[model samples]
Structure formats: structure tokens, C-alpha cells
Target: MVEDRRLAVLRAIVEDYVRTEEPVGSRAVVERHGLNVSPATVRNDMAALEEEGLIAQPHTSAGRVPTDKGYRMFVDRLTTLKPMSGAERRAISTFLDGAVDLDDVVQRSVRLLSQLTRQVAVVQYPTLTRSTVRHVELVTLTPTRLLVVLILSTGRVEQRVVELSRSELPDADALAGGGGPEVSAGDEPARVVDAVVADLRPRLLGAVVGKRIAEAGAALADLPAAVPDASRTLVRRVAEVLGEAMSDHHADERIAVGGAANLARYGDSFDSAVRPLLEALEEHVVLLKLLGEATAGGAVTVRIGTEGPYHQLASTSVVATGYGPAEAPATLGIVGPTRMDYPGTMVAVRSVARYVSRILDDA
Candidate 1:
């Protein structure tokens, strides 16, 4: 019972410190929180808490504030993560629902998180390796040139152009456009590209129906020889391009950041916190390190002050979560001072991440 009361006293002190941004006196803790105890009782509990190193007295005589350990205890001991209100949920859904594609989804997510949390928001793009093939589009630019577009379940699209050599084409001379034989329905270059795509598309889509990317790669491997001998070279080139798109680790893995200006609310005196986050935003590697552990599960991670990857931002905290299809997900979260509202920020970050994950799952 004594330890429980001390924890209550610590919780009250942390709450008041976050609100007033001042050292909380025992009288205020007693009167403001209605602890059903006297001022002397609260003072004794405060002394116990301070002795445990959970709360600190910055001055010789003043109310106590929570230390990094205290904040961690508060976060770890929280009984429940309160749900976002109906209005907040609807707003997040509506804002992200309007995104036209993958890039739009990420950008809108970053904006929504920043706006919702009023903190700097970071979101990583969905991984292609985990995404299923959505569609493959082939557009002919000319008799010798064709555009190959690869679409994925994550809403990411990759396009590449291929120029066929005369030696590889069965009817290269007749297939030429412009100064060559007039474009015809029977021999039009676009028709040739379409014929090849018709064969490639179904093989890719069928193999990846359940997110089997490797099977899709294997299905496409034989397409160069699978098609008619006339279009063999073109089919092989397009298949290679699509394979490259699937394995591309760089393009699909990128970070989107927003709301750096929110850091200013911490006050210039806390430049130590604000500046490091600002620099981390520019250096996505640091941001990735901070959010690296926030995998796709529905768990929210709270890294406070020195507990975070970089102790330099000792005055800052990170609340993050993973979003995307469960099989393959990316990270999203916020950065703010340790004094910021933890419960509210954690709720917002998680709420937005769920909505994003749902959107990608359905897409």
C-alpha cells in the first residue's frame, strides 16, 4: 500500500509537471489531484519517490519532477491506451482515404500524423518485397522502344523503357516506324508490345495472388522462351526489367517526414532537443535508427530521452508504431520533448498507423 501510494504521488507529479511546465509542490499535488491524503503524507511519499530516483527536486526546496526512469515507469505501467475519439478516427480515415496512390498515401499519412500529434512525424514507405503484384502495363513508344510499368499491392509503380535491337527482332525491318513501313493494325509496334504484355501480365498476377513474389519471379523467368519466337527478344527484355523492379530495395524503401516546425513549441532553451531532431529529419538514417524496432505489429514503442538510440537528444522522446500489411510493414512515429503529452501522442500515432495499415491491406 505504501509503494502504491508513492506511485500515485509520482503519477500526479508527472501529470502536473507536463501541464504547468513547473516544479510541482506537494500541496498542489494533494489539492489538485485529490489524493485523499494530507500535505504531509504527500510530502513523505514525494520524499520516498525522490529517494528512489524516480522523481527529482531541481532546487533545494520545490515540487518534484519525473526523471527519465520515472517517465519509463509511467509508460510501462500504464493500465490502458485510451482510444481516439470518434471525430479523430473519422478525420484520419477521410484524410488518408483520398490518396490516389502509394506516394500519396505516404505523404498524406505524414501530414495527418504531424497534424494529429502536433509533433514531427516520420513514415517509411512500404517494402516491395512484401507487396504483391498489382498489375503490369506495357506501352509502346515506337517500333524499337517500349515502356514497361510494374504496379504492386503497396501502390508503388515502377516503369522502365526497353529498346529492341534489329538483330533480335524477326521482322525488325518491317516493324520500324516513322520513315519505315507505315504503322498498320497488323504490324503496329504498339500491337507487338501489347501481345507480349498480354502473356506476361497473367503469369505475374497469378503467381503473386497470395503475395508470392519469388513465385512471380520464377513465372516470369521462362516467358522469354514461352512467347512466340517472333517476340522472344522483346519479352525477355521486358521480363528482366520487371524482375529488377521487384528486387529493387532502394526505391521502395524511403522515408517521409513532416512537422519539424512543431519542435519550436518546446521553446528555444530546449534547442538541445529541437536541433538534434531537426538534423535527424534531414539525416533519414538517424530517423530510421530511432524507429527501426517499430515493426508491423499493433504495438506502440515509447523511447524516452536517454533510452532512445541517440542520447544526445536527451530532452526528446519518440512514440512510434508499425503500419502496412502484417507480412511486410514499414515504420511511423513522432518526436517531441520528454515533457510532451505521452498518452495523447501515443494514441494518435497508433490510430493513424492502424488506418494506414488497413488502407494498404485493402489495396
Candidate 2:
């Protein structure tokens, strides 16, 4: 267990350093944190902390600064995040309530998070792989041509078309009457088409169908024994939709970044640190993988300095969390310098994540 006094001292140092962006001295920590401790006693604790590598001095006479380890420990134990204010909750509701669609929700989420945190924001769109099939429709355009459409639980739609030779055309009338009809070399009569439609209805119900035109063609060769060309179109449509949905979800595994301009204010370390981060933002996959870790971990994660893979992010830090329908969590959070205001940023990130999750859940 952490000593209460030590934790208090660490919290004071972190809060003070975050606000002032300067090294913290024991005197300053006591004065600002209102701790009932003498500077000399605090100094002894500071020395111990420095020895433990939780705090460091840039120079012999400089005040101590919290090391990355210090920040990590403080984050792990020293802070209790306050819930978002009513006004903040109202603002989030007001902003996200206006979103018309999934894309709108993502766009507004990034903007709201960035505005609230004053840091770069990253939001990953909801994944669709686990969504259930919603509906499938088959439309016949010609004796040999058909259109198939598939819709999924996630609001994604896909369509495909299938074509077959007229000779292979089953009796559409026979199918329409829910009866199968044998095919011959001659053109199918209207009654046979009706019977064929009637016969195929039972076979198509609730089955996860594929849209292989070749399969349909083979089925067509058997006449009354063959499936409808529309069935082939339906199968093709399902495959096409599933494939497209997966690809779209993969392509959209992105981070909606904001507040990059803030990095320029760092001056000296700006190019070395911010430039590479900006470049990495262009590679959506890498950012997705990074944020994916945070989401999967189900907590507020901090990646500091060189701990992150990209060398350009060495001077930066990322604080991320996953938020969505409790049943289907999605990721959203902020990226900023190691010097960022952790308490306030955490509040903003968690608050926005909750709101985004609510919006997606309702949608």
C-alpha cells in the first residue's frame, strides 16, 4: 500500500507541475497542496522519491519533476477522477443528439472530444463483424437476370446481380405457385414459371444463401431440379455485402485527430516530436493498432515518451479508453504531450466516451 502522505505529496507535485509546466519543490508542494507537513519532511520524501526514479531534477539546483514512473504511479493510485459536471453532460447530449447517421456520430465525436480536451482526439468507428444478418431480398429483372440485396444489423447494405442462360430458366410461373416443374429444351410456359416460384419459396426461407452465378448456372441446368437464378443472385449479394462490410470496417479503422496544431507551440522539440506523429496519423492502420490496445484493455491507458513505438511520439503521450454500448464497446480518446493536464483530460475523455457510446447504442 502507498503511504497516504507520500501519495498526497505525489498528487500535489503532479497537479502543480501539470498546471505550471515547471519543476516542483517540496515547499511549493506543501504550500499549494495545503498538506500539513513541513518543507523539510517533504524534502526527505522527495529525495526518496527521486532515488526511486519517481521524480528527477533537471539540474543540481532545479526543483524536482515527476518522472514517467512518477506519473504512472500517480495515475495508478493518487487520483480519483471527478464525474463530469451537469453542464458538461448537457453539452455532450446537445452536441451528439444532432448527429443524423453513423458518420455524423463519428465526426461529431472527434470534434467534441478535441474541443473538450484541447488535445488530439482519436475515435474508432463501430466494428460490424459481429452484427447479425437483418434482411435479404431477391428481385428478378429478367428470365436470366436477378438482383439480390442484403442488410445487416449494423445498418450496412450490400447488393449483387446474377445472370444465367435463358435455356436454363426454370418455369417462373410454377415457382410462383410454389411447385417445381421439370425443364425441357423448349421455352418454359407461363404456368411452369409460376409452379417453379412456388416450389422454391420453402427452400429459400431463413437459409444463409450465397450468390454464385456459376452455382446458379449449374442449378439452372437441372430445370425444375435447379434453383432460381434469383437464388444465385441472392447468394452473390450476401457474399458481396459481407465482404464489402468487412472491408469498409477495416478501412474505417481510423483515428479522427484534432489539436495537432497545439504541438507547434512546443517550439524547440516541435519538429522532432510532432512531425512524425502527424505523419503516423496518415497511416490509419498503425493508429488503429495502437488505440486497439487501449480499447481492449478496458481502461484509461497512458503511453509515455519512447514507450510508444513511433519515435516521433517520444515526447508525446496518449490517454485512451473504450466506450460504447456496454454490449459493444468502441474506442475514443485523446493524444497529447507528456505535459498534458491529466486530471482534466481524463475527465473530458471519459465523459465524451460515455456520450459517444450512448449515441451509438441508441442509433
Q: Best TM-score goes to which candidate? A: 1
**Residue 233 lDDT, candidate 2, scale 0-100:** 37
Which candidate tops lDDT?
1
Score residue 150 of candidate 1 by CA lDDT.
73
Runs off by more than 4 Å, candidate 1: 139-147, 159-196, 203-221, 250-253
- TM for every model, in the order presented, reads 0.85, 0.71
lDDT of model 2 at residue 39?
A: 94
RMSD of 2: 6.3
Please list the C-alpha lDDT of all candidates, in the order they appear.
Answer: 0.78, 0.64
Candidate 1's displacement at residue 155, Å, is: 3.4
lDDT of 1 by residue, 316-348 (tens): 888999888765678999988888778889899
